[model samples]
Target: MKDTEKISLLSRLVAMNTVNRNEIEPAKYLKQLFDDAGIKCEVLPVGEDRANLIAEIDSGSPILAISGHFDVVAADAKEWATDPFTLTEKDGQLFGRGANDMKSGLAALTIAMLELKAQQVPINGTIRLMVTFGEEVGELGAKMLYDAGYMQGVNALMIAEPSGYRICYGQAGTIDIDLESIGKNAHSSMPALGSNAVDHLIRVLYTIKAKVMARAAGLHNAVLNTDTLFNIDVFNGGEQVNTIPNHALAKINLRTIPEVSNAEILQIFHDVIDADAAKYGSQINMHVEMDLNPVVGDPQSKMLQLIQRVAKPYLLNAKFSASDQQQNQIVTKMLGRELPAGTIPALGAPGGTDARRLLVDQPLGFDYTVFGPGNFTSHQPNEYVSKSMYLDFIKMYEELFPAYFNEA
Candidate 1:
């Protein structure tokens, strides 16, 4: 596929409002693209208006698996300079909702797969591409595929997760928590007559925050660096100003390291919520929206060594990160690269990815790496990816695919 074709495909993908919750149309489109090229593709049904596209180009055996998410979180186009659904190219950047988050990576991989097929590149193994749905919503499609044995024979996984060309060898785990409180509604003027759900929920939230923060303190990991980060990202309470709210909701996000188990941290939340509920005399409910384990992939994998060999010493430049400079220096030195003062990508992802399923859970026992043209500005409004960076990513994959298959 040409650069123009790849850009055209990405534009069409951005135009579709396959909001993280709805990815069926885009999945179908990908399947059609594959079918036209005589590649075997399957639109694996997920849920309503959502599907995962799996396509394979056979060489001899299945080995390396590459994946990306087509579904993007809902975008508030009102905040964008142009329609978020319409891919806009301005000053060498392609602006759109999923452009940076992952759609660009998806496009690059698809184009690479097509080029490989067209060139009839000989390989000792097959190349599998998975365009999954709901990566933004806790990697639902990846979990589904993993459960269905899609990762059975894979040897390695290369995920295009927009790390600005840096290789991500590990990903933090995640626990999505929701806490709610129920009380009796009454006029705002008569505070004594009704239990304020909002007040009760807020009290519980503060307490939980303190406990979570305390739990995160002092612990550390060599790869992720931080112990754990927790935040109450979403909160909802009340309907009208004149009446006291009878219900309240708070959603918490917990990014975990490998040292702690999901269940252990979850229980701490449960205990805190239970205590607060009884103290406030309100009915409270807690829901675990999603729980994924952390995965530390082999940083010394031959796949990564091969990529760095081809990309060069420039790929080793350090990207300023929130992580401490000492930690960054340590990791860079470990990779057998001299640390440069120049900007580089984060050593590890602070948030979760489908890697929680692909690598941590041992579905295929595969080593994995994530690198792409996309960056951290993924879910924000007016997200974009540079054309040069995007094209470079495609070229990287093009070079890596044959080298990887032929070498190993």
Candidate 2:
């Protein structure tokens, strides 16, 4: 498709209020689009109108699944310079909630798949387009797909997550622990008569911070290039000012690497909490609500190599013509011109995505990597994506996937 047409489609996707609050509209739109393209579309149920979409150019295995998440983080309308729901163009950037975080990536990949089908490119294997919901929350949709056996026997899974152009081979794991402290309540005036749960929680936080952070400093993983650390991301305490709070809840988020097991990590937290409870005479309870193990990839995978061989050149050369190369050494130095600097994308990603749930926990074991038009601006105020970047990514997908499937 023409670039203008592609941009128009992306703008429409961004215009949709699929801000992860509801993904049904986007999924329905995509289903119709796939039907028009004569591709098979399936809806996997998650909630009412909160379903996941799977549209496929099902040729045969090994399937190369091109995936994205339709659900986006909730965008506050007030924080944006332009309407977060409306795709606004200013200074070559499109400002919208899901513009950078995903919708753009999703649109680009979807367009590529449509184009491939329209062209009737002879496919050697299947090219599946999978989009899920609840990614921003906890990858609930992706986990459901995994449970239903939708993530099996895929040779390679390419996620259109926001990654700039970073070909991620690995990513950090996330573990969320919900902790609560309950103590006897009394009137505030009687200070010593009742234990303060909030105070007890503070003591626990200080203790765990010291222990976990210090332990984190010592524990390192090469892929994550950092130590696993914990943070009290969500905390609730004290219902009234006049009474000593008898209950407090704090949720801890930990970024982890492959070396440590989730069970072992939970045990560490329990050890700290149990010991402190006995000493402080306060009731402490811990439950790990989420455990997403890290995804470690083989940098030497053929899929990654194919990406370098094809897409890298396209990105570098997109801005310059051969005549411009004659102005410089862009062709090569094999005594040749410097062909666009061939880049092997970053071997891993720092943040987590559905890759954690679908691939790490995906039973059939799909080799997964992440790429998209996402930038640092995602999940922040005034989120925007460069129109040019989105265009480049779509073009890359167009050229790369066919070669990947056909060559394989």
Candidate 3:
């Protein structure tokens, strides 16, 4: 397809309000596109009004998986210069909510499938295309697929996340904790008679932060930043001004490096809470909100060599960087108490994506890497992708499939 046509396709995808909450419309549209291209497609419903699209060029062994998320982050209409859902061109950039963050990547893959179908590219193995939902909200769709065993027997998996044409080979794990403190309620006038749950909770949070910072101070290659150590996103306490709160809840987010296990960190947090509870005579409740393990693809594997070969002819250089290494390193440094003495793994750090759930928990056991066009604009206002970048990505996919499928 021509560059303009490719941009137009991306524009249509952006026009559809496939924001994280409403992905059905785009899922339907994409299914139709695959149908028109004569590719076999299926819609896997993830939950109420949410679905995932799985299509295949052909079905058989040595399957190569191409994946992208159909959902985009929510956008505020007032924050955007143009309608956030409508694609507009300005200064050579296609501006829209989903344009750059990923709808463009989905379009690029769709167009490649169409071109490959028209050319009747001889395929020795199957190529699977999956457009998933809820990647922005903890990779829900990917987890669902992994649970259902949809990724069985995949030789290689490629996720088209916006990475500026680079390859992502490693990422950090994420763990969220919710802690609540309970104490006896009493009138504010008699402050000494009542236990202040909020006060005790703050002390515990501070302790956790200090522990993380101490760990970070000892690392050389793996430095921790205070920002990623612990985040108290939500705090709730007494409803009335005159009364001391009997209960307080705080939510903490911890992004962990591959060096640490979620279980280990959870134990540390529990110990901190237990000590605080003992001093205050307050009940402590702790729950894990989410746990996403880190992922790393082999950089020297045949997959990396194949991707480089496919991208080189188009003058696109692909480098492997883990998606969220910086965030993970900083968080781990702050949370870990001991100086972790070891050569930091050669793999790149983790960034947030559905690849985590798909490859980490799933039995597919395929070597997974993320490569795509577009710059990083996820969850931001006025995101966009270039017309040239979109089309070039299509060409790359077209070249990649045959080689990947024909390999013995």
Candidate 4:
């Protein structure tokens, strides 16, 4: 596919309102593209208005997979200078909601698959494009796919998560928790008559902050060289100020390291909530919203080494800067610290990706890498990816698939 066709596909994808779990339409659109090219594809419905698109070029053993998500975080148009749903290009940057986070990577994957099919490239293994939905929220689609035996024969996998061309071999795990307190409602004027759910929940929160948060900071992971970071990001208590809150809810998000298991964290929450409930005489309940394990691959793995080799020329000869000034400054500093352009180092991703879902059962099951276009504009207003990098990624993917097959 030409650069224009790639951009056009990306534009149409961006124009679709896929925020907050609406991905069925986009899945269908991609299916049509594959169908038109006479490639075998299927749209697996995940939920209402949500689906996963799987297209494959079947051959033999050692399946090589390219996985990416189509869902994007919520974008408020008022906060963006341009329409968040419309792909806007200015100063060599394509701006949109999913432009940086992942749609650009998805577009590149799509184009590469089409190109490979059109050229009738011979391969010893299968090439599968596993596009998922609801990755932004909880990786629900990825979980569904994994549970349904989609990854049974995958020998090598590349997740097209936005890495600014950096080779990511590992990522931190995440646990989202929700805690609620239940009590009797009463007027604020009569505090003695009714139990305040907000008060009860606050006590629990204080205990968690002092006990869990304090200890998490000291728990370190030797492999990733990081500590668990915990935060209580949401709280809901009462509907009106004049009445005592009969119900209270608190949401906690924790970026975990390998040092502590998710089960250990849950145990701590259960102990704390049980104690608080007993002490306050209020019904306190806890639920695990999502739990994903961390994965760290061998930095010197054959897959990564091959990727580094294939990507060297592009990285060294690349000519593009971030459209956002702040983003450019950060990238410049990072590159300065690790000089010699075109050098792709294997590093741990700060944020989690679909790799967590894919590798949950076996952390080191396969050679995995998260490499893609776009800088540090993910989930922010005015998200953008340089046109040069986006196009280069398409070329990279085209070369990468066949290169892996030849070398594997």
Rank list by lDDT: 4, 1, 2, 3
Highest lDDT scorer: 4
Relative to the true structure, candidate 2 reaches a TM of 0.87
| TM-score, cand. 3 | 0.85
Tens-digit per-residue lDDT, 134-217, candidate 3:
888888888888788878887788888775545666566688888888877889999899888878787888887777655544
The lDDT, on a scale of 0 to 1, for candidate 4 is: 0.84
Who wins the TM-score comparison? 4
The digit string of per-residue lDDT tens for model 1 on 1-408 reads 667888999999888887866688888888888898888899988667889889998776657899999888888868999899999998778899999888899988988888777787776688888778888877888888888888888888888888775688777788888888888899999988998999988888888778776776778766765678888898999999999899999998888887766777887878987787667677788888888888777767767777666555334432333432454455566555775443343356567678787664562224778877765677898888878778877877888888887784
**Which residue pairs of candidate 2 clash?**
330-338, 330-339, 331-337, 331-338, 331-339, 332-336, 332-337, 332-338
- lDDT of all predictions: 0.79, 0.77, 0.73, 0.84
For residue 301, give model 3's deviation from the true position in Å: 2.4
Where model 3 places Cα greater than 4 Å from the true spot, the runs are 212-228, 239-242, 316-350, 362-366
Off by over 4 Å in 2: 187-193, 239-244, 318-340, 362-366
Where does model 4 exceed 4 Å of error? 185-194, 214-217, 222-225, 238-245, 322-337
Candidate 4 residue-wise lDDT, 154-227, digit = tens: 88889888876578788888889898889888999998899899998999878876776666766776545568
